[model samples]
Target: MTASGLPMPGGTGGERELLEQWLDLHRATLAAKCEGLSDEQLRRTSAPPSGLTLLGLVRHLADVERHWFRRMWRDEDSAPLYCTETDRALGFVVTEADTGAEALAVWRREVDRARKAAAERALDEVAVHPRRTDWQTSLRWMYLHMIGEYARHNGHADLLRERIDGATGF
Candidate 1:
């Protein structure tokens, strides 16, 4: 584990295990970035020009998890947690009513659902994309896509964290 108590990514493992570990590591890294922060701090923007915030990232990730795992993978009728057609980036639009605790809780629930959705599925198992009817995606691709999504957002989270406070590192 690192100083934040998150499990370290495994050095050696099977493909599935490695993917899951790396995904979890990135997820935990996002959570770790919000540690020791107040609700106001979580909502604080990284800079004036950018509206990115730790809370917004948490909410956006929750929707991403739901979209990929439940909506697409399981073909469930789960609506987005925050986003809508009018405001596609609604999840990243934190309002005065939004709180860090609630956002984190929702994100955690989505993560749990995502794990359950993929648990028994083989990597090569294919599913139709919910939005793109002509596109078929495999479980392996979903895992890889999710890892990249988290990695990219975690980079944003890192910048947001450093801007919020002096906190930096892994």
Candidate 2:
């Protein structure tokens, strides 16, 4: 558990295998981004003028997955995974308390919620989008979106991690 009290579940063999693969890859990529780094290192903004950090990416993607997979596509009445209309920039702003442990907890919790939402319906099941004026998406669509979003961010994470501590190649 790396002294974090979170068991790192090994292997991806639950629900859909391909879906599990995507989730595993993203999860590993996030870990890679913060690997060999201390809390302060993870929380430091990369660019002097910009407010972006490895920890923030973890926080942001957790909220992103929850917002799309849980809130919008699942039509969930649950609260947002993090942030709200009140704090739009919370994802990019890391505080002293935003440690690896806290970030991983949020990510895992949101992922669990997303999996529940995804499992409750078939791939063809549809939900009206909260933002689009005329849009409806299937469970499959949301799944694909979440996977694709994380994959894209994983690339960004690779670059950012390299800049942070000369670590690369995930």
Candidate 3:
């Protein structure tokens, strides 16, 4: 594993193992992006007219994890942590009360719950869609979706981190 705890997915691992490893790598990569930054830096936006911050990304990802793993996968009745009924993008809008430590802690907790829920079901097991009951999804697809989600956001995080302190290539 590297500084981000990004372990290279082994070549001979099973499908589930490989997917989980990849997902974990991306998760760790995001965490690593937020490393060594102060609260102010974490809350700084990358460009003008954009409210996207490292802390906001962390909070948003937490909601994503909870939505997929806990609410959808486990069929739990859960509400949004940072989002509101009218503003679904509230997680991306950081307030003065929001702190990097708190957002990261929440994200870690959501990751733990996601892992636990995923372990309880096989990759092929179908979970009902949270909004549309007529639609169903498999655990495998969820893992893939999350991996992609992390990958996309990690790219944004990379840019944010770079702009914050001129740090690159974590």
Candidate 4:
């Protein structure tokens, strides 16, 4: 277990097992769309997928980071700053006014919240869900769930970006 007490990304020996490898692949996929592109390139989206661009991916991840780690775990009373405040229906929609720099900033802010929430709770600590009256989960479970969620959506991002530029992979 690393600082989080959930095994390190590749384990202690630096050998990545099935799950870690899977998660890393998706993480790279998510990060790849933002590469080799300026603010303009990252913000372009074509058809389908609701024209969701990479900057929007960053924005959504920022929302995800806040939803799972911060508000759900730390402060349920507080509203999600990035998601609900922005377009509720189209969280992934990329606008012409959006910029890569702004999206990155939003993502970093949410990530900071995630880290703070993680630091406050232990692996086995249970968080009560304010919205979902029936749900409660350990911090460890939330961590695993979050990474999995990101990995899945990152796959979506990979396909979307590939269709955009024919420049494959994450």
TM-score ranking, high to low? 1, 3, 2, 4
Best model per lDDT:
1
Tens digits of per-residue lDDT for model 3, 62-130: 999999999987889978899865687999998777899999999999999999999999999998887
Candidate 2 local lDDT, 21-132, one digit each (tens): 5665677667767777888888877666777888888888888877777777567765655577678677767788779778877888887877777777777788887757
TM-score, per-candidate, Cα-based: 0.96, 0.79, 0.95, 0.75
How much is the lDDT of residue 141 in candidate 1?
97
lDDT digits (tens) for residues 14-126 of candidate 4? 32244444444454456656666777778777565466777777787777777778867786565665467546545676777878787777777766667777777767789
Going through the candidates in the order shown, the clash numbers are 0, 0, 0, 0
In order, candidate lDDTs are: 0.91, 0.73, 0.90, 0.67
List pairs with backbone clashes in candidate 3: none
Candidate 2 has its poorest 10 consecutive residues by lDDT at: 1-10
**Candidate of highest TM-score:** 1
TM-score for candidate 1, residues paired by index: 0.96
- Cα lDDT, model 1, residue 47: 85
Mind sharing the TM-score for model 3? 0.95
Task: Name the better of 1 and 2 by lDDT.
Answer: 1
Q: Model 1's lDDT to the true fold? A: 0.91
Task: State residue 7's C-alpha deviation in candidate 3, in Å.
Answer: 2.0
List candidate 3 stretches off by more than 4 Å: 3-5
Question: How well is each residue in 23-118 modelled by candidate 1, as lDDT tens digits?
Answer: 999999999999889999999998888898999999999999999999877889998899984576889999889999999999999999999999
